[model samples]
Target: MASYGNDKEDYLKRLRRIEGQVRGLQKMIDDDKYCIDILTQVSAVTRALQSFSLGLLDEHLAGCVVDAAAKGGPEADAKVREASEAIARLVRS
Candidate 1:
């Protein structure tokens, strides 16, 4: 029932990739890798997650927000507010 349901598999694949990157980070730490190198990889992982979050947010706006807006009522307002809050959170992060 979620907006990302249609692309759930793709999302999962991305999450798995991110998970792998995290494991890689752990390995880098355990191996006592160079500080700069590890920091670079950490930046890469952060960017990946940010990109993923943005994609999901776009899908939510396109699917859920649009659908609710079309119906024109309190639900639509709530959806818009929910989406605004989500955006704010993303921005803060």
Candidate 2:
């Protein structure tokens, strides 16, 4: 199992909520909801996902990445680059 540390419960709860939102979006699609309304919901879901990603990224940087960097090795640099690329992709999306 993955360890989310102190924010595990909160993160899981948020993820569940996001799942429900996605379900709701699916329902709206089935009901032929308005395009603007559907788009709004999509935007909300995207923002929520981004928020979750940011939280996890912050934790990774503070914990795993930092710890690795303190060791002053190639692995640490790789982690830093990986984290940077991940954030860039998130932002681009």
Model 1 Cα shift for residue 44 (angstroms): 0.6
Report the C-alpha lDDT of model 2 over 1-93, residue by residue, as the tens digit: 233588899999999999999999999999999999999999999999999999999988888888889997899999899899998998899
Q: Which one wins on TM-score?
A: 1
Tens-place lDDT per residue, model 1, 21-93, is 9999999999999999999999999999999999999999999999999998999999999999999999999
Model 1 local distance difference test score: 0.98
Clash pairs for candidate 1: none
Per-prediction TM-score, please?
Answer: 0.97, 0.90
